[model samples]
Target: RYDVDAIHMDDYFYPYPIAGTPFPDDRSFSRYAASQGFSSTQRGDWRRNNVNLLIQQIKYTIAAEKPWVRFGVSPFGIYRNKRSTPDGSGSETNGLQNYDDLYADIKLWVEKGWVDYNLPQLYWEIGHKAADYTTLLHWWNANNFEQPLYIGQDLKRSVDKNELDVKIRQSREMSFVQGNCYWYGYLMLDNYREVYDHLRSQTHRAKALIPAYTHMHKGRPAKVKKLADVFTEDMHFLTWEHPKQPRNPETAQRFVVYRFRKGERVDISRAENIVKITPDNFFVLPYESGKSSYTYVVTALDAFHNESKPATIKVKL
Candidate 1:
């Protein structure tokens, strides 16, 4: 009982919906079945097995990978149904749930100490008929995890002038839900200005990071060697090179460099960046320093936040 140290996890994978056939559970198991975990036709049971390995792997693997790190998942909220069973994790009207359809028994994971937290995707308006905030919220709070619980909200959904008002009020009304994760960071800028007010408000802002496993591996990165522009004063010029990435062995390889001036954070407020960053090989940084300086640094960022080592070039103004 006292052997383990921390929880570890991954996001919900394999999105729902089967094309023409139903969710391939029995079929998957029959065609590629190993020793059975449970004997049943309930597609939900097999689906649970699909995620069960993930949940178990998340726990043990985290212990193996980084024992001190905690793991959690933010599955689509509704857990299960009371009408179907005596004890389910949904409200009277809560629709098909993660446990039933998506086969994520997140609560079981929390209760069994398999996970450290559950960030339920509670992204609904306060009084919405199908999935009211008040009821589902209480359900989550009432069903406490041995770890912790957090809400993942759709802040962009609050961008509506009318809905934004209610969301602001609702934020003020809850306490036990702990903190929140705006569905995505861009939501902060996309939301109605008043919605920002609610987030910045004293009451809601007081609840900062919820206490949990805070340690994880963020690897040290390599440094920039040099930086210089290949393009001259000519406007539509382009230039690029690489360090770690292997270039063409049989032919001269081409590279595209997205240039920006020093000290320019990516501007998310607008549809694009403020200093006019471009993807066509090189970008013209319009600031005084950029116009004068020839040295510049370049880094890579994947569609996700996986950042790459910086490559640099040296030149004269």
Candidate 2:
């Protein structure tokens, strides 16, 4: 009944085990284990399979109903410790793992394409005793399994330790780590430790479009048409016509407006050049007294963020 861009799952899969007490699931497991063809010795496998089935069912159901909506999971930072895995596919950290403690096979989910994206919550400091942030960051980047990998940063820990900027720079350096999601939105919005200032002035200086889901739909929408300027009393507006009705991925659901000085080269690839990304076909132009001439380029973006060709218009004051 409601439309959403994506469905996301957080790190809480199975509860952390209590010391000296096993999970009281023997009766339930015995009832359905044989029907599912699981032996008593495969209890751990059965637990992992339960979570796996949930992931697969959600993916399939979303695809059947709304194919455009993406499914992503943010699992615990450590998939497994090297000491636990004989194949040496795990990280070097000595921490509670998603595989052993939580019974979440996040790596298998990513490899099987059950989740569209994987974001590991690496909330520890750079050189934490149990789970070093950098160590797990590099580990996740290497084992992304050809899926989009984003880092889940704990805002308080990063700000308190004065390593937020360093972590951002480090993630940018890794080729496979696409982005970072700050945990606890209220802290950032409240400007905890000047994080909001840091982001606005340094890290996130310019507007940016969300990464396009090219793996799902690579086709670009049709370019916008009839680009022109409109004047209403004292307001200057840039307007364009939609290439097609905004009903599907092939039509324009949003537009990207980029402004450049008359002598400057037009480059839409630069996020700094982006003026506004809006669903409206008209943009209210901000008049500058000294700037008499400017060049503006507009492009159409579909729901999947697939961009169309440029529609250029030069405006004279």
Candidate 3:
């Protein structure tokens, strides 16, 4: 079986409502209502219950098989508007609500601890008339209900001067925002407006480990052993014996390699020095001949990516 890290579902729950039209699920609903202990009169409620059952069952199956595999959803940005659910509506946006319109009770799932994380699609700009990005960001952040919360960003808008910058800045400023999930990865890769370069140079200069979920798998992996530096084909490669234990919960799933300049102190905690997160025990050091000597450190990572104590070697260029 493949060992996947996480399973994510986006805003594909119930369809966004269309004017003067209703989704046709009556035949299936009527067929299973009595057997499922619900009534035909409760059609709307039945539909919502069906979606809930599906989400919960998926989570249960994944957890039973691999407790470390996370399950998350990216629902529509607005849960409800002030007019519809005055008590529970978290924002001023009048856009479609996942709760009322789509019958996907995202808040209940988060409140009941059914999801590992929730990434709502807050795709509008800062001052849009219907759904302001800033407004929905705070709304989602406040309503996370202890579950990890990440925002779904519109990557196409990232080229606009103040748009991506403000979104990233605000995310960094907010304590509840775990991170962001960019929409349309290909556009960023195509370097639309040089967004990729901008991100690499400024916002994301270093790699970060996915945040830990301590409740599930809470231990570090064994350290790398017998690390050695070898030069081959004009490339400096570091190969090491894999951690003694390699498959269980506490065993190494991959390795994190960090490289520091000769005079600088080696720090595994900082992401700037990190060269790679790889499954192989060997890593090619980013060394230029005639340049300063570099110190390299390698650490093992468990299924949950908890890093082990480092094993280090200093090499001359």
lDDT of 3 by residue, 1-317 (tens): 98678998988888888898989887888789879888768776777888999999999999888877889998988988877775756578788888788999999888876788889988888899999888888888788875688999988865564599898788777778889988888977898888889888998989888776665667877778899999888787899997444346568888888888878987777888888999898987665575568788999888776888899998876
Candidate 1 local lDDT, 1-317, one digit each (tens)? 34333442434554565657675445677754345654545445766777777788767866675454566778776676567566543565557677766677877787877776777877777677878766676777777553467777776665552454454455445554545667667656764555667667732543221242322223322332334445456542324533433221211112223333345543232222222233234555433434553434444322112234556554333
Ranking by lDDT: 2, 3, 1
Q: In model 3, which regions exceed 4 Å deviation?
A: 1-3, 34-42, 86-89, 158-162, 230-236, 244-249, 286-293
lDDT of model number 2: 0.89
Ranking by TM-score: 2, 3, 1
Best by lDDT: 2
Error of 3 at 3 (Å): 4.9
lDDT (CA) per prediction: 0.53, 0.89, 0.82
CA lDDT, candidate 2, residue 217: 84
As for model 1, its CA RMSD to the true structure in angstroms is 12.0
What TM-score does candidate 3 get on C-alpha atoms? 0.86
Indicate the worst ten consecutive residues by lDDT in candidate 1.
Answer: 246-255
> How many pairs of residues collide in model 2?
0
What 10-residue stretch in candidate 3 is worst by lDDT?
242-251
Candidate 2 lDDT over 45-154, as tens digits, reads 89999999999999999878877788999898999999999998889999899998999999898898889899999999998989999999999999987578899999
The residue ranges of model 2 lying beyond 4 angstroms of the native Cα positions read 243-247
